[model samples]
Target chain A: MTRLIDVENLTLRFSTDEGMITAVDNVSFSLEAGEVMGLVGESGSGKSVTAKSLMKLNASNASYSDETKITLHLDDGPVNVMDLKTSKDMKVVRGGAISMIFQEPMASFAPAITIGDQMVEQLQIHTDMNSKQAREVSIEMLDRVGISDAAQRFKQYAFELSGGMRQRAMIAMALSTKPKLLIADEPTTALDVTIQAQVIDLMKDLVKEFGMGIIFITHDLGVIAQTADKVAVMYLGRLVEQGAVRDVIRNPAHPYTRGLLAALPQLDDLEKPLVPIPGDIPSPLERPPGCVFNTRCEEKVGDICSAKVPDFTNVTENHRAACHIYTQGSDK
Target chain B: MSDDVLISARDLSVHYPLAKGGLFGPKPVVKAVEGVNLDIAKGSFFGLVGESGSGKTTLGRACLKAAPITRGTVRYTDGDVDYSLTEIDNTQLKDYRTRSQLIFQDPYAALSPRMTVRDIIAEPLEVMGLTNGREETDERVREIAAKCRLNLEHLRRFPHAFSGGQRQRISIARALVSRPRFVVADESVAALDVSIQADVLNLLRDIQQEMGLTFLFISHDLSVVAHVCDHVAVMYLGRLVETAPTKDLFKAPRHPYTKALLSAIPSLDPDDPNKAQKLEGEIPSPTNPPPGCKFQTRCPFAVDKCRVDEPKLEHSSTDHVVACHRWQELME
Candidate 1:
């Protein structure tokens, strides 16, 4: 398998009125062609910020660390995403090699422009396609995404479509360019469960057909289990755990991951009461001194948990976690 | 009505008239909730599950008498009083407001930014004249806030100063301060992080148990409903398709819609083969719904009979109701 993207020591901060607040702490992960990686985290977990960093999509106030590096391996060559200083230079990563679909399809699409026109515009910008070719490709993509009457829907504005259809159209537009990597940011969160199922299946099929890597971001672990080949669990802007989907979910190494699993209401086991992780996620300004999850973790070992950040320790050949319990000499 | 029934609805419907479409032959009406029967047992946590446009929220509003009851009757009875929601007068409605309250979904928008947490929680008591004076209101506010796990310091801060989960606790504190007998939590935990969502859910459960309060928990997430609710009801296009004890409903769902819904939830076990019966097509528009079954368009087992004559709710088993023509055959 070809390596599609590699992110190393990515750290992000924003210059705010209050002061500089770190949105994404040191985080690293990679994806290969045809692989699906699920980025699971709650609000302020910085999952979105990390995804945005891949395309340099953060606002002007945002800044990245000097040690941060993002490399996209394209057929032509390897491009350093962090080195893209201009919007023109960032264009290749933004939509050509990487396409993103947002949670709210309504906000993503222009109310005035027809869906077809917007898709055609995206294609024209990303690929060497003419107006006529782009339109045909857009319609084909719409049909491929299971939108009925693709031509009619092509001419319809975003408002004319139902919530599910609008979401499908968004996926159609994102995949129309045939990018190497697709970043789906809670794409199914806003849709109904039934529609969410349809979208999830559609993405799985598209991945098989297009051989594109996908970074699926969602707070729902269930969705991740069904879609992602690998999973990365983040808390308070830090990547706390990463492993194959089965390993991470079945035998979560980190306390935060275990707490998250315990908190969820599982269908298979209805007798169990939900155990919420104690305390709240600290605000970015009050970011915890050491392990981000120490405040809420039930299995806190000692003062070391609040004194120093633990480095990643291997739980298995393919699974790893950042927590004192898993560290060698953290208790001392 | 049984003595245990806290709130009951018979043939309930809520329809909203749209503006005339250029001298239309007949004015269009959005049948937000139509021909429904429901019973919420006292001191029980009842879950209503549905997708958007399925009218779960509208049904909840109608039960609270917040939405106009266009037809049928909704009766609320406690040990002290019994009131029919359909024929409620201004005095009774005002009294009813003190007994029934709603917790909205978006914590960010639900809370008033200008009000301090203390004032926000105390407003309900002041509006209802439940407390004697400023001191009494403050005392009541502190009590409920403490129950919601909000500290004395939190009460002095504005909504902007707190995170989503803390703001939600404030809202919950506000709703409970008046000592309402019945509460409607409409997607209350949907906005919080997974860890915090669990905390709030546990708080809601604890509050319900301590107060001996009846709760109508409306959510799109099935897993959350499964764990928190004793009984669960599935709604589609403003109609009840199935209602059963949560255990029975999840273990052996009779209605095809309910079955599809349960299956659609992505399993946490990655090794489990996903045999989800993906329901195809979006929910039919309320204004132009199909004549017979609203879900027939997407139901895999929908037949000719399901297209011409609407099915009525019938007993699938003791205390379990299902409205599907082919449910029996499909179950076999």
Candidate 2:
């Protein structure tokens, strides 16, 4: 009930002009304090590069590899978020102990600032707040995210708000510095499914009033079965399964999570049909050497899922997966 | 009507105008398909749901006149073919653009990355002349790329070498290789992967019953338009609040903006989470909309005569219709 963020064999790579490309491959998982977790996949399946490598937010031809640890468990004790190493030690691991939110809240705001001056300049650059107590805690976190005239919608701007009020003013400027790990990534993929179900019931009421740890990312498996209390999945950039969102949405131990839940069309099933897991997911410079879903797997174990890389297998007691047809002697 | 109804519209509208106006600024326009009647019955599939400035891709490109019809009338017909998209010109709008096509919604910008999938599906029958040799356009682009499961040897490769459901089946084999007796598609599986969006919606409902064609589809995924539409319709800001038969709008969804968009859809039984009657704000600016039930600005039972009258879409039963103003007091 309180571990909050840890990762281990988390390898990553990039050196781009088409060379060492892996993007978060040996991924591991953990996150507890008010858990949410989900990651899901598709779209270069690295699930927003593992929630932007928990706040390092990759870029400049990213190439930091091997034993990629991360840690965190705070109360001023275990924080090595990959040994921070300056941007002023990643300002307490970005937004004061992690607070992401992305999939474009108008390209992460600043269309000439305003939403209460970009949430009082992100609570005066990560708190020790000033400017009238960061404009009274950014209009009380934009009236606790429902955002109605929250002090005149905090003086307006991100193109005068709406894409669900610029994602509830980017989740009230990433929960006005209340961060013990948030991440988000596809924050309701450019909204509008009733504003992505009111931003997933406002991130499940800001995870029951900020107990915090979310992670979330999404390629919408019904928004990771309604805001994931653990679920992992991803593909081409590996981490194959992980579980307990009702055991991977009711028993889905990877045939690419049962072809992404029989290619989901179930509003209580309308005479089922979307089977599609038949080929074509192979490119990040033609990756498929080993189960990056053995070229669209429909239970393929041939040449052991195109030559090895299976590992994980625990399959319940809160799931796990990876695949050579769920391992044990590899069904060969 | 077995003699296929290919296309229909009847009320249509496509608007646009306003580029930085002046002269007393009155004529501003941008309705983006306001009148909106529809038919598309021929080989039937029909869907169209909404949200994203709900014009459902400009009422599916103004029913293939490819936008800018601005107001009313369209007809098309098919067996013994008739026309009339309000005086079809420019060579019968280049012969109704080879019987109406579309398919778009970005397979990474609908493939023109230096063309290849055999010249982007034979550049729509070599720019609509249909097929004047290259062995009859490679035997009709190898029979619509093997009826879109694709792989007539991945047609000489390129769309950055496929995947996103094989470039949405090479954008549905270039909108069904000019055989198009009306197609539209628009958010063609809204950029794939929910298991390749139900395998490009069951390959557009098996190429609309194997090329007797018709389609339309557009989507904001109401459970993949209730398992691929047989008449759906919904839309919102630019009108048409209901229209049924997809199991009577998923069994009794008579428009309070189609039951808050089918209860803001996130139900895969995560212990029944859909508390969806959320809408209390945003979605107004269809250029200052919200006068008369264009969903009275985030409707929750909106009244005051629904902000001064304007509800008329009616027919609540046989073939559904709706448009609210208290959909009969939320259906009693």
Candidate 3:
């Protein structure tokens, strides 16, 4: 697999009224070209924030730590994303080479502007296409995402379209720039289940056609299962497990991952009721010293689970998780 | 046997008058719910599923008399007292309001941040004049709070101090405090995290069993509706496309819309790679819907007939009712 984007020791913090809150705590992962990677986490797990950090879109209150290295391997050469200071310099990493779709497509668009105009604007900014060329390309992309009457739809405003159409338009605009790395932050969260299903299918197809690496972030386990090839599980801003989708779902070594799977309501399993993890997610300020999920974990193994942070242990060649139980097994 | 029929809606229609009465012109209207018939079996978890603007919520509220019904009749019977909704006088409506309650979506919005948990839960009882005095109200509130798994000590603290799941539980307790026979839990756990969602769901199921209460659980999530609801009703553009027992609906959805809805959900198991059913386009606007089937715009099996003629909801089997011209064809 060809390496696309490499994130190493990426630590991020936000200066909130409470304290210096660590949003993405020393999280490290890499994506290969054409690989669909699922970033699964509950709210405040820092999935979206970590994706935003790639384009340097953190809020004004965000503060970065030293050694936060994020390198993108483009066709030209390797570029350190953290060091790209100026907007001119950052443009290469932003919409030019990297793009994003959001949970709510309406927010990504101006209500007053037509969906086509927004796409054209995005394409124009990133490419040297003329208005006519942009218009054609935008319409084609819209059609590609399953929006019918593509030409006439170009004249319609965001509100004039339904939620599913708006979502498709947003996807079309995001991909119109043809970014190598697409960060979709809970793109289908706001959509209806059926509409969400359609959006997820479109994304999987887009990945195959466009051949780009996607940082797919969502709390829906079912979506991740259907779309993602590899999965990375996050808890309180830390990576708990990362592996091939089949392996993680089949055999989750981490207690948190197991709990999450058990908690999911499935059709095949009506005999057993859903068992949610015992307690509420701790506030970032009250983050545990060692294991983030120790508070809610069913298999918390005494002081070690709370007093010392577990190291990442490879359970399989491609599967890795941070837990002491796996460390007790023979090293792979 | 008769006691099992908690609430029955017969051709219920809720139409809002668009406030524009010109000098000599009649007021225009927006038909939110149009001729809907439904029945809630006693102690049964009934799920109402629909996209935005489907008017499912209005249908729910009309049962409680919260929304004005322009046409059709709604009958409410708790085995003891039975009243026809459309013909019911103010006195009977007031008594019904105390028996049928609403659990709002968006816990943060549904609950008052200014009020403590105890007071929040106590509001419904106080408002409806259910209890004789503060002592009886506090006792009832505390009892439901315990069943909801709310911490008694935390009841003194405001809603801001609670998490989404906790706040939702408080919402449930508040709705239940009036000793209502039925609850309209409109998107109750829609905003919660996946793991927390399971917990809240389980809580609801347990509460349903204990309280012997009928739940008109309204949500857009098929997976959630599948697990929680005994019976499921699929709505689109102010009409019920299909209604069946939850298991049967998931296994074999008769309506194209229902099948499309089932096909749209992402399965959680990575090995269980179920591709989403890709619909052609968006749902049409209710005000300017297509001449025939509302789903015809996006229906894959749509023919010329579908574009011009409406299909009445027909039963595929004893319990299953579907509205589609090609439902039999699709089953083949």
Best by TM-score: 1
Tens-place lDDT per residue, model 2, B129-242, is 777778999898888889887878768878876667788888888878879788888778877777677777887787788777878788887888888887888888788878
- The sequence of per-residue lDDT tens digits that candidate 1 reaches over residues A1-332 is 99999999999999999999999999999999999999999888999999999999999999999999999999999999999999999888899899999999999999999999999998989899999999999999999999989999999999999888999999999988889999999999988888888899999899999999999999999999999999999998999999999999999999888999988989898888888888878889889888988887788888988999989988998899998887745445
lDDT of each: 0.91, 0.80, 0.87
The TM-score of candidate 3 is 0.95
Query: How would you encode candidate 2's per-residue C-alpha lDDT over A1-332 as one tens digit per residue?
Result: 88987888787888767787887788888888889888888888777877777667788687556588878887888887777766887888788888888888888887876778878877888888788999988898888888877998888788777788888888888889899888888888888788888888888988898888888888788877887888888888888889888888888878887787887888777878778676657667668787778776767857878888888988667688888766755554
Better of 1 and 3 by DockQ: 1
When summed lDDT is taken over every stretch of 10 residues in candidate 3 chain A, the lowest stretch is: A323-332
Comparison by lDDT, 2 against 3, better one: 3
C-alpha RMSD values across all candidates:
1.7, 20.6, 2.3
Task: Give the alpha carbon lDDT tens digit for every residue of A1-332 in model 3.
Answer: 78999999889999988889989888889999999899999998999999999999999899777988998999999999988888899989999888999988778789898888888987888889999999999999988988889999998999888788888888898998889999999998888776776787789889999899999998887888888889999999999999998999889889999999888877676656788988899999889988888988888767878888888889999999999777655543
Per-model i-RMS in Å? Answer: 1.0, 10.8, 1.6
Worst 10 residues of 1 chain A by lDDT: A323-332
Indicate the worst ten consecutive residues by lDDT in candidate 2 chain B.
Answer: B1-10
As for candidate 3, its clashing pairs are: none
**TM-score of chain A as modeled in candidate 1:** 0.98
DockQ winner, 2 or 3: 3
What is the two-chain DockQ of model 3? 0.72
**Largest lDDT belongs to which candidate?**
1
